[model samples]
Target: MPKMIFVNLPITDLDRSISFYEAVGGRREPKFSNDRAAMIVLSDTISVMLLTHDFYSTFTRKPIADAHRTSQVLLALSADSVADVDATIDKASSAGGKVDPGPKQEMGDLMYGRSFEDPDGHHWEIMWMDPQAAEQGASAFEQA
Candidate 1:
Protein backbone atom coordinates (compact mmCIF):
# COMPACT_ATOMS: atom_id res chain seq x y z
CA MET A 1 0.00 0.00 0.00
CA PRO A 2 1.16 3.55 -0.67
CA LYS A 3 1.63 5.90 2.27
CA MET A 4 0.07 9.36 2.31
CA ILE A 5 1.17 12.49 4.14
CA PHE A 6 -1.19 15.08 5.55
CA VAL A 7 0.00 18.50 6.71
CA ASN A 8 -2.43 20.44 8.87
CA LEU A 9 -2.18 24.19 9.04
CA PRO A 10 -4.11 26.85 10.96
CA ILE A 11 -5.61 29.55 8.79
CA THR A 12 -7.25 32.83 9.71
CA ASP A 13 -10.04 32.30 7.20
CA LEU A 14 -10.90 29.03 5.53
CA ASP A 15 -12.18 30.59 2.32
CA ARG A 16 -9.34 33.08 1.98
CA SER A 17 -6.75 30.47 2.72
CA ILE A 18 -8.32 28.12 0.22
CA SER A 19 -8.24 30.81 -2.46
CA PHE A 20 -4.61 31.67 -1.79
CA TYR A 21 -3.63 28.04 -1.89
CA GLU A 22 -5.51 27.55 -5.11
CA ALA A 23 -3.65 30.44 -6.68
CA VAL A 24 -0.38 28.82 -5.72
CA GLY A 25 -1.11 25.50 -7.39
CA GLY A 26 -3.20 23.75 -4.78
CA ARG A 27 -6.35 21.96 -5.81
CA ARG A 28 -9.35 21.59 -3.52
CA GLU A 29 -10.43 18.14 -2.42
CA PRO A 30 -14.21 18.34 -2.17
CA LYS A 31 -14.51 14.95 -0.53
CA PHE A 32 -12.51 16.15 2.46
CA SER A 33 -13.89 19.66 2.67
CA ASN A 34 -16.57 21.31 4.78
CA ASP A 35 -17.39 24.67 6.33
CA ARG A 36 -14.46 24.72 8.75
CA ALA A 37 -11.80 22.98 6.78
CA ALA A 38 -10.62 22.22 3.28
CA MET A 39 -8.15 19.75 1.87
CA ILE A 40 -5.53 21.11 -0.55
CA VAL A 41 -4.22 18.29 -2.66
CA LEU A 42 -0.55 18.52 -3.75
CA SER A 43 -0.01 15.08 -5.17
CA ASP A 44 -1.29 11.55 -4.91
CA THR A 45 0.57 11.05 -1.64
CA ILE A 46 0.68 14.60 -0.31
CA SER A 47 -2.14 16.82 0.97
CA VAL A 48 -2.48 19.94 3.08
CA MET A 49 -5.39 20.44 5.43
CA LEU A 50 -6.35 24.07 5.82
CA LEU A 51 -8.36 24.48 9.01
CA THR A 52 -10.00 27.59 10.36
CA HIS A 53 -8.40 28.92 13.54
CA ASP A 54 -11.38 27.98 15.67
CA PHE A 55 -11.59 24.49 14.25
CA TYR A 56 -7.85 23.90 14.41
CA SER A 57 -7.58 24.97 18.04
CA THR A 58 -9.95 22.19 19.01
CA PHE A 59 -7.44 19.62 17.78
CA THR A 60 -4.63 20.80 20.04
CA ARG A 61 -4.29 22.12 23.56
CA LYS A 62 -1.14 24.10 22.78
CA PRO A 63 -1.53 27.60 21.45
CA ILE A 64 -1.22 28.00 17.74
CA ALA A 65 1.88 29.81 16.54
CA ASP A 66 1.44 33.08 14.71
CA ALA A 67 2.61 32.26 11.23
CA HIS A 68 3.02 35.91 10.35
CA ARG A 69 5.42 36.50 13.21
CA THR A 70 7.24 33.21 13.07
CA SER A 71 6.97 30.03 11.11
CA GLN A 72 6.57 26.64 12.71
CA VAL A 73 7.17 24.65 9.56
CA LEU A 74 8.78 24.78 6.13
CA LEU A 75 7.33 22.82 3.24
CA ALA A 76 9.63 21.74 0.42
CA LEU A 77 8.77 20.44 -3.04
CA SER A 78 11.21 18.87 -5.43
CA ALA A 79 11.34 19.73 -9.12
CA ASP A 80 12.81 17.80 -12.00
CA SER A 81 15.08 20.64 -13.13
CA VAL A 82 16.45 24.00 -12.06
CA ALA A 83 14.28 25.83 -14.61
CA ASP A 84 11.20 24.09 -13.27
CA VAL A 85 12.07 25.22 -9.77
CA ASP A 86 12.50 28.83 -10.89
CA ALA A 87 9.24 28.81 -12.81
CA THR A 88 7.29 27.53 -9.83
CA ILE A 89 8.85 30.14 -7.59
CA ASP A 90 7.81 32.84 -10.03
CA LYS A 91 4.27 31.54 -10.14
CA ALA A 92 4.17 31.44 -6.37
CA SER A 93 5.23 35.07 -6.03
CA SER A 94 2.76 36.18 -8.68
CA ALA A 95 0.04 34.35 -6.80
CA GLY A 96 0.70 36.36 -3.59
CA GLY A 97 3.49 34.23 -2.15
CA LYS A 98 6.97 35.54 -1.32
CA VAL A 99 10.25 34.30 -2.68
CA ASP A 100 13.24 33.91 -0.44
CA PRO A 101 16.52 35.80 -1.01
CA GLY A 102 17.32 33.92 -4.22
CA PRO A 103 18.39 30.58 -5.60
CA LYS A 104 21.50 29.02 -4.08
CA GLN A 105 23.70 27.34 -6.63
CA GLU A 106 26.12 24.48 -6.16
CA MET A 107 29.03 24.41 -8.59
CA GLY A 108 29.31 20.64 -8.71
CA ASP A 109 27.66 18.08 -10.96
CA LEU A 110 25.43 16.65 -8.23
CA MET A 111 22.57 18.94 -7.25
CA TYR A 112 20.88 22.32 -7.49
CA GLY A 113 18.14 23.97 -5.43
CA ARG A 114 16.05 27.08 -4.73
CA SER A 115 13.81 28.15 -1.88
CA PHE A 116 10.81 30.41 -1.29
CA GLU A 117 8.14 31.17 1.26
CA ASP A 118 4.40 30.77 0.96
CA PRO A 119 1.82 33.47 1.66
CA ASP A 120 1.24 31.93 5.08
CA GLY A 121 4.93 32.15 5.90
CA HIS A 122 5.68 28.52 5.21
CA HIS A 123 9.17 28.14 3.77
CA TRP A 124 9.61 25.92 0.73
CA GLU A 125 12.63 24.51 -1.06
CA ILE A 126 12.72 23.22 -4.63
CA MET A 127 15.56 20.98 -5.62
CA TRP A 128 16.92 18.77 -8.38
CA MET A 129 19.71 16.21 -8.44
CA ASP A 130 21.67 14.20 -10.93
CA PRO A 131 21.39 10.48 -10.46
CA GLN A 132 24.87 9.92 -11.81
CA ALA A 133 26.36 12.35 -9.28
CA ALA A 134 24.58 10.63 -6.41
CA GLU A 135 26.21 7.33 -7.30
CA GLN A 136 29.57 9.11 -7.10
CA GLY A 137 28.83 10.34 -3.53
CA ALA A 138 28.56 14.02 -4.42
CA SER A 139 27.23 16.28 -1.65
CA ALA A 140 26.99 19.66 -3.34
CA PHE A 141 23.36 20.39 -2.74
CA GLU A 142 23.13 18.81 0.72
CA GLN A 143 23.83 22.06 2.56
CA ALA A 144 20.94 23.96 0.96
Candidate 2:
Protein backbone atom coordinates (compact mmCIF):
# COMPACT_ATOMS: atom_id res chain seq x y z
CA MET A 1 0.00 0.00 0.00
CA PRO A 2 1.10 3.55 -0.56
CA LYS A 3 2.17 5.77 2.31
CA MET A 4 -0.30 8.14 3.93
CA ILE A 5 0.03 11.15 6.22
CA PHE A 6 -2.18 12.21 9.10
CA VAL A 7 -1.75 15.69 10.57
CA ASN A 8 -2.96 15.65 14.14
CA LEU A 9 -4.19 18.90 15.57
CA PRO A 10 -5.51 19.58 19.05
CA ILE A 11 -8.89 21.22 18.99
CA THR A 12 -10.99 22.65 21.76
CA ASP A 13 -14.28 21.89 20.06
CA LEU A 14 -14.56 18.71 18.10
CA ASP A 15 -17.81 19.43 16.26
CA ARG A 16 -16.85 22.96 15.32
CA SER A 17 -13.49 21.87 14.00
CA ILE A 18 -15.12 19.19 11.89
CA SER A 19 -17.50 21.76 10.46
CA PHE A 20 -14.66 24.13 9.68
CA TYR A 21 -12.71 21.44 7.87
CA GLU A 22 -15.73 20.36 5.87
CA ALA A 23 -16.42 23.94 4.85
CA VAL A 24 -12.98 24.14 3.27
CA GLY A 25 -13.54 21.02 1.15
CA GLY A 26 -12.45 18.27 3.53
CA ARG A 27 -14.70 15.24 3.74
CA ARG A 28 -15.27 13.76 7.16
CA GLU A 29 -14.68 10.04 7.42
CA PRO A 30 -17.39 8.71 9.63
CA LYS A 31 -15.69 5.36 9.98
CA PHE A 32 -12.82 7.10 11.78
CA SER A 33 -14.79 9.80 13.51
CA ASN A 34 -16.38 9.97 16.96
CA ASP A 35 -16.98 12.34 19.82
CA ARG A 36 -13.36 12.47 20.85
CA ALA A 37 -11.86 12.94 17.42
CA ALA A 38 -12.69 13.42 13.75
CA MET A 39 -10.81 12.30 10.69
CA ILE A 40 -11.05 14.85 7.92
CA VAL A 41 -9.94 13.45 4.62
CA LEU A 42 -8.19 16.12 2.60
CA SER A 43 -7.28 13.63 -0.10
CA ASP A 44 -6.81 9.95 -0.66
CA THR A 45 -3.41 10.05 1.04
CA ILE A 46 -3.80 13.01 3.35
CA SER A 47 -6.00 13.22 6.44
CA VAL A 48 -6.32 15.74 9.23
CA MET A 49 -7.02 14.28 12.67
CA LEU A 50 -8.80 16.75 14.81
CA LEU A 51 -8.40 15.44 18.34
CA THR A 52 -9.88 16.84 21.48
CA HIS A 53 -7.40 18.39 23.89
CA ASP A 54 -7.95 15.63 26.40
CA PHE A 55 -7.33 12.97 23.81
CA TYR A 56 -4.37 14.77 22.21
CA SER A 57 -2.60 15.19 25.53
CA THR A 58 -2.38 11.43 25.75
CA PHE A 59 0.03 11.32 22.84
CA THR A 60 2.67 13.61 24.39
CA ARG A 61 4.05 14.36 27.83
CA LYS A 62 4.64 18.05 27.20
CA PRO A 63 1.99 20.69 27.69
CA ILE A 64 -0.18 21.43 24.71
CA ALA A 65 0.70 24.81 23.31
CA ASP A 66 -2.05 27.22 22.44
CA ALA A 67 -2.15 27.18 18.65
CA HIS A 68 -3.57 30.69 18.55
CA ARG A 69 -0.39 32.13 20.04
CA THR A 70 2.27 29.70 18.86
CA SER A 71 3.73 29.02 15.44
CA GLN A 72 5.09 25.52 15.53
CA VAL A 73 3.80 24.49 12.15
CA LEU A 74 1.81 25.65 9.14
CA LEU A 75 -0.47 23.30 7.23
CA ALA A 76 -0.32 23.89 3.50
CA LEU A 77 -2.15 22.30 0.57
CA SER A 78 -2.03 22.70 -3.19
CA ALA A 79 -4.83 23.90 -5.42
CA ASP A 80 -5.56 23.58 -9.14
CA SER A 81 -5.42 27.33 -9.76
CA VAL A 82 -5.16 30.74 -8.11
CA ALA A 83 -8.94 30.96 -8.08
CA ASP A 84 -9.11 27.70 -6.15
CA VAL A 85 -6.79 29.09 -3.51
CA ASP A 86 -8.95 32.17 -3.10
CA ALA A 87 -12.15 30.12 -3.04
CA THR A 88 -10.91 27.95 -0.22
CA ILE A 89 -9.89 30.99 1.81
CA ASP A 90 -13.23 32.59 1.16
CA LYS A 91 -15.03 29.50 2.39
CA ALA A 92 -12.85 29.48 5.45
CA SER A 93 -13.74 33.10 6.17
CA SER A 94 -17.45 32.43 5.80
CA ALA A 95 -17.21 29.53 8.19
CA GLY A 96 -16.03 31.72 11.06
CA GLY A 97 -12.35 31.26 10.20
CA LYS A 98 -9.88 34.12 10.02
CA VAL A 99 -7.70 35.13 7.09
CA ASP A 100 -4.04 35.69 7.87
CA PRO A 101 -2.86 39.17 7.01
CA GLY A 102 -0.27 39.06 4.26
CA PRO A 103 0.14 39.88 0.61
CA LYS A 104 -1.01 37.15 -1.76
CA GLN A 105 2.01 35.42 -3.25
CA GLU A 106 2.71 35.30 -6.99
CA MET A 107 5.84 33.79 -8.44
CA GLY A 108 5.73 35.47 -11.84
CA ASP A 109 2.41 33.81 -12.70
CA LEU A 110 3.68 30.33 -11.94
CA MET A 111 2.59 30.18 -8.34
CA TYR A 112 0.11 31.80 -6.01
CA GLY A 113 -0.75 31.27 -2.32
CA ARG A 114 -3.01 32.59 0.42
CA SER A 115 -3.24 31.96 4.13
CA PHE A 116 -6.03 31.43 6.61
CA GLU A 117 -6.56 30.40 10.20
CA ASP A 118 -9.03 27.70 11.13
CA PRO A 119 -11.53 28.23 13.88
CA ASP A 120 -9.11 26.63 16.30
CA GLY A 121 -6.38 28.98 15.12
CA HIS A 122 -4.38 26.43 13.16
CA HIS A 123 -2.66 28.15 10.25
CA TRP A 124 -3.26 26.89 6.74
CA GLU A 125 -1.98 27.94 3.32
CA ILE A 126 -3.54 27.15 -0.03
CA MET A 127 -1.26 27.44 -3.04
CA TRP A 128 -1.37 26.83 -6.78
CA MET A 129 1.54 26.03 -9.10
CA ASP A 130 1.75 25.95 -12.86
CA PRO A 131 2.25 22.34 -13.91
CA GLN A 132 3.94 23.15 -17.23
CA ALA A 133 6.43 25.51 -15.69
CA ALA A 134 7.08 23.10 -12.84
CA GLU A 135 7.91 20.36 -15.33
CA GLN A 136 10.19 22.56 -17.45
CA GLY A 137 12.92 23.59 -14.98
CA ALA A 138 13.66 25.80 -12.04
CA SER A 139 11.17 28.49 -11.12
CA ALA A 140 11.75 31.95 -12.52
CA PHE A 141 11.58 33.35 -9.01
CA GLU A 142 14.51 31.24 -7.94
CA GLN A 143 17.76 33.09 -7.34
CA ALA A 144 20.79 32.46 -9.53
Candidate 3:
Protein backbone atom coordinates (compact mmCIF):
# COMPACT_ATOMS: atom_id res chain seq x y z
CA MET A 1 0.00 0.00 0.00
CA PRO A 2 1.10 3.56 -0.60
CA LYS A 3 1.84 5.97 2.22
CA MET A 4 -0.84 8.29 3.50
CA ILE A 5 -0.98 11.31 5.77
CA PHE A 6 -3.51 12.12 8.40
CA VAL A 7 -3.25 15.57 9.94
CA ASN A 8 -4.79 15.38 13.37
CA LEU A 9 -6.13 18.65 14.70
CA PRO A 10 -7.36 19.51 18.17
CA ILE A 11 -10.62 21.30 17.78
CA THR A 12 -13.09 22.91 20.14
CA ASP A 13 -16.14 21.99 18.09
CA LEU A 14 -16.40 18.89 15.98
CA ASP A 15 -19.51 19.73 13.94
CA ARG A 16 -18.42 23.24 13.07
CA SER A 17 -14.94 22.10 12.14
CA ILE A 18 -16.40 19.43 9.89
CA SER A 19 -18.52 21.99 8.15
CA PHE A 20 -15.59 24.30 7.70
CA TYR A 21 -13.51 21.55 6.17
CA GLU A 22 -16.34 20.59 3.87
CA ALA A 23 -16.73 24.15 2.69
CA VAL A 24 -13.06 24.19 1.84
CA GLY A 25 -13.55 21.08 -0.36
CA GLY A 26 -12.87 18.20 2.04
CA ARG A 27 -15.31 15.32 2.05
CA ARG A 28 -16.18 13.82 5.43
CA GLU A 29 -15.66 10.09 5.87
CA PRO A 30 -18.45 8.72 8.01
CA LYS A 31 -16.74 5.38 8.47
CA PHE A 32 -14.07 7.07 10.60
CA SER A 33 -16.23 9.68 12.25
CA ASN A 34 -18.36 9.95 15.36
CA ASP A 35 -19.70 12.64 17.68
CA ARG A 36 -16.29 13.44 19.08
CA ALA A 37 -14.13 12.83 16.03
CA ALA A 38 -14.27 13.17 12.26
CA MET A 39 -12.18 12.30 9.26
CA ILE A 40 -12.10 14.77 6.42
CA VAL A 41 -10.61 13.50 3.21
CA LEU A 42 -8.67 16.19 1.35
CA SER A 43 -7.15 14.07 -1.38
CA ASP A 44 -6.44 10.49 -2.35
CA THR A 45 -3.54 10.30 0.12
CA ILE A 46 -4.37 13.11 2.51
CA SER A 47 -7.02 13.28 5.20
CA VAL A 48 -7.61 15.38 8.30
CA MET A 49 -8.52 13.95 11.65
CA LEU A 50 -10.61 16.39 13.64
CA LEU A 51 -10.57 15.56 17.32
CA THR A 52 -12.24 17.28 20.22
CA HIS A 53 -9.96 18.67 22.88
CA ASP A 54 -10.82 15.85 25.23
CA PHE A 55 -10.20 13.22 22.59
CA TYR A 56 -7.01 14.85 21.38
CA SER A 57 -5.50 14.98 24.86
CA THR A 58 -5.42 11.20 24.91
CA PHE A 59 -2.90 11.20 22.09
CA THR A 60 -0.53 13.76 23.60
CA ARG A 61 0.29 14.65 27.20
CA LYS A 62 1.48 18.16 26.40
CA PRO A 63 -0.84 21.13 26.59
CA ILE A 64 -2.52 22.00 23.34
CA ALA A 65 -1.25 25.34 22.15
CA ASP A 66 -3.70 27.96 20.98
CA ALA A 67 -3.19 28.11 17.25
CA HIS A 68 -4.30 31.71 17.12
CA ARG A 69 -1.24 32.88 19.01
CA THR A 70 1.37 30.25 18.15
CA SER A 71 3.29 29.35 15.03
CA GLN A 72 4.62 25.86 15.43
CA VAL A 73 3.58 24.67 12.01
CA LEU A 74 2.02 25.96 8.83
CA LEU A 75 0.05 23.55 6.65
CA ALA A 76 -0.11 24.03 2.91
CA LEU A 77 -2.10 22.40 0.07
CA SER A 78 -1.28 22.33 -3.60
CA ALA A 79 -3.58 23.96 -6.13
CA ASP A 80 -4.00 23.27 -9.82
CA SER A 81 -3.62 26.91 -10.76
CA VAL A 82 -3.15 30.36 -9.28
CA ALA A 83 -6.88 30.96 -9.64
CA ASP A 84 -7.62 27.81 -7.67
CA VAL A 85 -5.44 29.10 -4.83
CA ASP A 86 -7.46 32.32 -4.68
CA ALA A 87 -10.70 30.37 -4.86
CA THR A 88 -9.70 28.25 -1.88
CA ILE A 89 -9.01 31.34 0.21
CA ASP A 90 -12.42 32.65 -0.75
CA LYS A 91 -14.03 29.40 0.26
CA ALA A 92 -12.25 29.56 3.59
CA SER A 93 -13.52 33.09 4.17
CA SER A 94 -17.05 32.05 3.30
CA ALA A 95 -16.81 29.30 5.86
CA GLY A 96 -16.02 31.84 8.63
CA GLY A 97 -12.25 31.44 8.45
CA LYS A 98 -9.81 34.35 8.49
CA VAL A 99 -8.39 34.92 5.02
CA ASP A 100 -4.76 35.81 4.62
CA PRO A 101 -3.93 35.26 8.27
CA GLY A 102 -0.28 34.79 7.29
CA PRO A 103 1.99 36.65 4.93
CA LYS A 104 1.18 36.34 1.23
CA GLN A 105 3.84 34.53 -0.82
CA GLU A 106 4.51 35.42 -4.45
CA MET A 107 7.22 34.03 -6.68
CA GLY A 108 7.41 35.73 -10.02
CA ASP A 109 6.49 33.29 -12.78
CA LEU A 110 7.17 30.43 -10.44
CA MET A 111 4.61 30.19 -7.68
CA TYR A 112 1.67 31.78 -5.91
CA GLY A 113 0.29 31.13 -2.45
CA ARG A 114 -2.36 32.48 -0.14
CA SER A 115 -3.10 31.89 3.50
CA PHE A 116 -6.13 31.37 5.71
CA GLU A 117 -6.95 30.51 9.29
CA ASP A 118 -9.55 27.88 10.06
CA PRO A 119 -12.30 28.60 12.54
CA ASP A 120 -10.16 27.03 15.22
CA GLY A 121 -7.27 29.30 14.21
CA HIS A 122 -5.26 26.62 12.43
CA HIS A 123 -3.12 28.31 9.81
CA TRP A 124 -3.26 26.95 6.27
CA GLU A 125 -1.90 27.92 2.90
CA ILE A 126 -2.97 27.07 -0.65
CA MET A 127 -0.21 27.22 -3.23
CA TRP A 128 0.28 26.69 -6.96
CA MET A 129 3.45 26.25 -8.93
CA ASP A 130 4.02 26.76 -12.65
CA PRO A 131 4.30 23.16 -13.82
CA GLN A 132 6.82 23.83 -16.56
CA ALA A 133 8.96 26.00 -14.37
CA ALA A 134 8.75 23.55 -11.50
CA GLU A 135 9.92 20.70 -13.72
CA GLN A 136 13.11 22.66 -14.34
CA GLY A 137 13.61 23.60 -10.67
CA ALA A 138 13.81 27.05 -9.12
CA SER A 139 17.48 27.43 -10.04
CA ALA A 140 16.61 27.27 -13.70
CA PHE A 141 14.03 30.02 -13.29
CA GLU A 142 16.47 32.15 -11.30
CA GLN A 143 18.86 32.15 -14.19
CA ALA A 144 16.23 33.36 -16.66
Most accurate candidate by lDDT: 3
| lDDT tens per residue, model 1, 1-144 | 699999998877778778877876789999999999999998899899998889998999999888667867767776777778778778777777777644575545567777776556667777777776656563534542
The CA lDDT of each predicted structure is: 0.77, 0.89, 0.93
* TM-score quality measure for candidate 2: 0.92
> Which is better, 2 or 3, measured by lDDT?
3
Error of 1 at 6 (Å): 0.4
Q: 37-132 in candidate 3: lDDT tens per residue?
A: 999999999999999999999999999989988976899999999999999999999999999987788887688999999988999999998988
Error of 2 at 84 (Å): 0.5
Estimate, for each residue in 1-144, the C-alpha lDDT of model 2 and write its tens digit.
889999999999999999999999999999999999999999999999999999999999999888788877887899998889989999999999989644677786788899998877888889898887667667545732
Ten-residue stretch with the least lDDT total in model 3: 135-144
What TM-score would candidate 1 get against the native?
0.83
Query: How do all the candidates rank in terms of lDDT, highest first?
Result: 3, 2, 1
Query: Which stretches of candidate 1 lie above 4 Å from their native place?
Result: 101-108, 134-144
Please give each candidate's TM-score: 0.83, 0.92, 0.95
Residue 14 alpha-carbon offset, candidate 3, angstroms:
0.7
